[model samples]
Target: MTATTHTRHDPAAATLLRFATAGSVDDGKSTLVGRLLHDSKSVLVDQLEAVEAASRRRGQDVPDLALLTDGLRAEREQGITIDVAYRYFATPRRRFILADTPGHVQYTRNMVTGASTADLTVVLVDARNGVVEQTRRHAAVSALLRVPRLVLAVNKMDLVGYDEAVFAAVADEFTGYARRLGTADVVAIPLSALEGDNVVAPSAHTDWYSGPTLMEHLEGVEVAAGSPDAPARFPVQYVIRPQSGAHRDYRGYAGRLASGVLRPGDTVTVLPSGQRATVAGIDVLGTPASAARATQSVTVRLAEDVDVSRGDLIAAGAAPRLTRDVTATVCHLHERPLRTGDKVLLKHTTRTVRAVVREITYRTDVDTLERRDAAGALDVNDLGRVVLRTAEPLALDDYADNRRTGAFLLIDPADGTTRSAGLVGETSAWGAP
Candidate 1:
């Protein structure tokens, strides 16, 4: 099928895109990423030379492109990616931050970390193998995390003679599965990462295909526009007070705006304290500003000294639900099992409170999309639901409504090791029931 063509965008005025790559082991993810960087002229001479020397030491005539992203020594020796390797590069039409995540099933937690903040995820598939179990797992994880876009990269097309029929079958099967998982925006492309086909440029071998190259699609895909209409959420990180200065009485709450816009005269409420105040002033980088938007680190002066402190949330417009009971979908990251009645520390934005797991509702089988009910415990890499009761009240939004304010971490209070990553609210179709 021919893909729609987009108008060429200007390179100088392009925006940044954050994307990630994931697939089963040996599906050529790292090689595809390396080729994307090399062909786009994003690689430096010294880096290329290092890769070449490493390839020679391994007794290879040609450079192994996978070496570019497999930075860990154990990974290089094992010929498998164990951790997520992040790379930044820019094309003429766009800039990108690419996270090359591990393809091994045991390291699925690493994939979650890489894709948590990604706007898009490229799921690679070897033409010979089609869509495997790991591929479905990655797609389910992406769907659960609410990754807006997906790319079904059919790699190793050369091994299948670049046959349109082979590509079509794989794409159709994967697309149907992704749609079932509630991932609607999926684009499939046929390419050979080893031969550099349809990656940075179109492939002559696939003359029947008339789709935009991977680079072109990446350059033109729409990213999520900032949440300007959502209610403003700013978690107070620090309380700044001047002792000896022209502004000795300057009192401001310092933190990055998590969402929406904050402006002078805007009415806000401090969470947990339930005190109301108006935004008296905004200071950006020591200079007074008229307004502050999402992600901007600014100090906001309140009209009333409402006894705000670290771990407090300053909200505008709509108020978040303040509660001690939280039902959340979580992915266990630690080897120690998370069981009911286990005491853990829940770390939300700027706030850490003691919590106990009340129940393990169920565990979801990613491959089958089935819910295993009455699960007693969650092992490492398990996706499940949990009911948690905290010692103090927390102001929180649903993960679907606000990712920044709705996400949190569960930590082992004794050693401070992060045990799980959680999202507040009900599970989606692909997640726990």
Candidate 2:
């Protein structure tokens, strides 16, 4: 008897949370992240020693925790974060992938990249400054990305005399603004990243406050487990066929499931061709599988020899819309401006197709949540709407409904540089078209 090996999907691994941090200049985003790592015992001895030595060179008595995250030499020298720094840490309760983003306005595009895949975002605000324009901008970006959870870390509490009233006011203002931006799950916590108050352990200063510590909230927060009812979407990346082996007759469509679950005997439709086929088998890492969930890479064998190729979508349940005209919300990432009638490459899922920028609809004002239509082109870090005409039809889902299948990127065909990140639906506070 041939013993079959099955892929074991561990439930504990689902506790892994991907989160990002954003703030204005000197809001102590790096300090807060460093404090989290240090307090969580994720920092190494050599790394701490290096930070201590660097702090001493700057005539500081205490080690600058911020140095732990500001890895770039330019950032350390300038005393600011110039790029996104990613770190990994784990606790008994959960594991985390942290993207500590830059605070400078010029590097807002870096924040977009970090927070795009984050399940939660920590938006820092200095207690003394309350809520500033950059605070609003970070919140707006978090909302735009559809981040499931938000943490308003009112930092520098010690600098404000650990005043409960100050924390309350800042929390109220930020929460109200976040609510207006359509973000409902906002958790506000007051802490001092410098003095280590209420970050890992609960602080004794705030006697009136009865909320959990930052670490507690992060560990306990519910990570979204994708709904099983969602339509299964698998964008064919590679067609596997062995011409000279025992499996010569076997042909499989390989890709990661974008959402929902796929199982054998499920009826699926091949997009762009509209061919119907049944899932005859599901293989995970060369092992036969009974089912494959979202984000899992697997090879699917169809009962019929369909003409499905790379870039084709195999969908089960609700079908995605097929269209060549795409209206999307985009964030320009490159220094080169995105103008009307510019020919570019639109990469969606595993497919790359030629596309033209039909129009620059409007640029969004992050501060005021206003849509400005006068702008003829989208500049670096500019969030706006645009119309794209593609050379080939694409199967797409609304970004609001499915983050995986509903997102795409605009690439410069000349140099293959990524110009913008786009979402396939209107994403704004005013709900304007």
Candidate 3:
């Protein structure tokens, strides 16, 4: 199969991917990340020395790789990661941005915030413990968020003597449960995160395993390429008119492409107003591209003036669905529960509007996947179906269709803080009585 070529700001680098890690306490999530970075030669000598020094202070022979990820003083004292720590590293093959997140029950909200923009998720599992509740919780969140790819890293093989049976058992249990959560792909790898085994370099100790190493799998995974002819959806961010002498007629509509490919001479429409125009050109960081794809930032120039503004979607071919009614499944994060009849702000893509909680469907029991009718509303860490009536129409898609356009965040109108995360789906059958 021929690999799809992605456009990069610098022709030298291929593309950048963002991923997040989740697991239970002592499951070796941080150690796995630290080892991946260290074995990839992404760490500097000074950083390595600091980790070693910290290890010695904790009375350890080998340096604790987890310390490299848990950088905050409070996190170090608690021996856990509290906030999301983003790390950047690049190999000759690809560049990566990793979001290292916390594992405890109280910090589930933080995990959601970190994994919101992730294209893939790495769910670490302790080989000794097999499939635990924490593993299930992380998998549930990954499914709820609709992450495209999933990698199950079964850490601590050394303690289990690199036993193939142990690896298979953990892999089977985790994969079985993950399948129920709607995971698309699950690749299992047995490794000792602390020993640099099968992280960056292939592990000779695991001749029984025949899969690609963690780093190799990541580098070779086929991410979705840009769509060239799909419906164009550009939520206008801000209008840019340089007003400089060199470019006085430069009326640039600034925003990231939500879907489809756009090029010059294409006929386009502005949503909510039904105005139509032709594309004159595209600008990327002051340069023009023959075409641009979804997720790329660009300024689109229209051949004629139409009433365009921020929050309006500029589309090509067909327009996205616009309505004030939204039925979605949401995971409540804040301490306060989201009850029926409460008014909140639903932020979908770049559009924000008032949304009333029309109904509370069934609250899903995480462990059993059973619908519970007893709960009046969803509390923290609870998943439930919700019916919301927005004050205005939103150009939105189904969560299963386009994650970028289908997903949304509920903000507290009183305090301006995010309260819940939602995915478009049928809420009628799932709602509570």
Candidate 4:
């Protein structure tokens, strides 16, 4: 047997958790990220030395802490993060992949791309500034993305003398606003990212507050294992079949479990066709599973032959509702603008289909949290309600119900680049047609 055939037996290997950081300009997002890396000892000694040298060149009293994360030369000069810089670190508890994203008002698309796969979001806020427009915008994006957990890291607490009142007010303001956007669990913690207070370890300065440190909370938070409780949504990527072997009868449906659970003996129905079959085998990576849960990319073997193809979804419970007409709230992140009647491609999970923008309902003012009607086109960083008519039927769920099923990204068909991020919701009458 070949090496590929021999190594397909092990199932439990490693787990990956992705998280993102967001906040307004100079709110210490990159600083907190640098601190996390610095405190966790994830940075190399050589890298630290380089950053220190660069800091000294700038004539700072201390290392310009932001230097640790601002990798691009232009970013350092501009003193702003312009792209998503991903860093990895681990403790004995769990492995983490952190996407340190840009915080400028113009880079909302980059934020969406980074946060799309994140299980949690940490929105940093300056304690002195209570809550700003970007704070609300970040929180709104977190809610729209269906990020399971939200951590309001109120940074620069020391600047406010670590006063409990300042922390309380900022926390209350953010918590109240987040609730309006449907964030279920919000944890607020005050810290000075630059001073190493309450980031990885607890500081004695805040005696009135008693909560787990950021590191501890990250280690203990229970992330849902692959959305197994949701209805199974397997977007068929490819059909596996063997042609020239003694065991030539092998045929499998290969795809990742987008949501819900699938067991070997469970009966499943394929969407678009509604054909049914019994799952005879489940293969994770290459190893077979007696049962398979959500988020696992496994190849499934059916007991009976069935006609199935790519872009088709298979499920055991009630299938995701199929629709060609969709209304959704979207964040326009493309350099090019979005206008009604524009043709584009909508990619949801593993499936992509042609779609046309039917209407632009209203643009959301991130600063005031107000909806502006009579907007002509959605510009970069603009959030608006949109309606789309697809050329093909999509198996979609409410974003609040199942994020993996309800969320989609719009792609510009001409260049094959993503143009917008959308969350399924209700429609209005005022959108431009």
lDDT winner? 1
Query: What residue runs in model 3 are displaced by over 4 Å at the alpha carbon?
Result: 1-12, 73-82, 241-246, 426-433
* RMSD score of candidate 2 (Å): 6.8
**Candidate lDDT (C-alpha), each:** 0.89, 0.87, 0.80, 0.80
Tell me each candidate's RMSD, in Å, in order.
2.5, 6.8, 4.4, 7.7
Clashing pairs for predicted structure model 2, backbone only: none
| lDDT, model 1, position 111 | 85
In model 3, which residue pairs have backbone atoms overlapping below 3 Å?
Answer: 361-431, 361-432, 362-430, 362-431, 362-432
lDDT for residue 389 in candidate 1, whole number 0-100: 98
| Predicted structure 2, TM vs. truth | 0.93
Segments in model 4 whose C-alpha atoms lie over 4 Å from true places: 1-16, 72-82, 374-376, 426-433
Candidate 1 yields a Cα-based lDDT of 0.89
**Model 3 Cα shift for residue 192 (angstroms):** 0.5
Comparison by TM-score, 2 against 4, better one:
2
lDDT of 4 at 69: 74
Residue 136, model 1: lDDT of 96
Angstrom error at residue 80, model 1: 15
lDDT by residue (1-433, candidate 1, tens digit) is 3243344455457788899899998899889988998889898999999999999999999989888876652563564322567889987778899988878898778888888889999999999999999999999999888887899999999999999999999988998898898887888989999899999899999998887789988998877645789999999999998668787888899999999999999999999899999999999999999999988999999988789999999999899999999999999999899999999999999999999999999988888988887468999889888999999999999988887899999999999989999989964667534
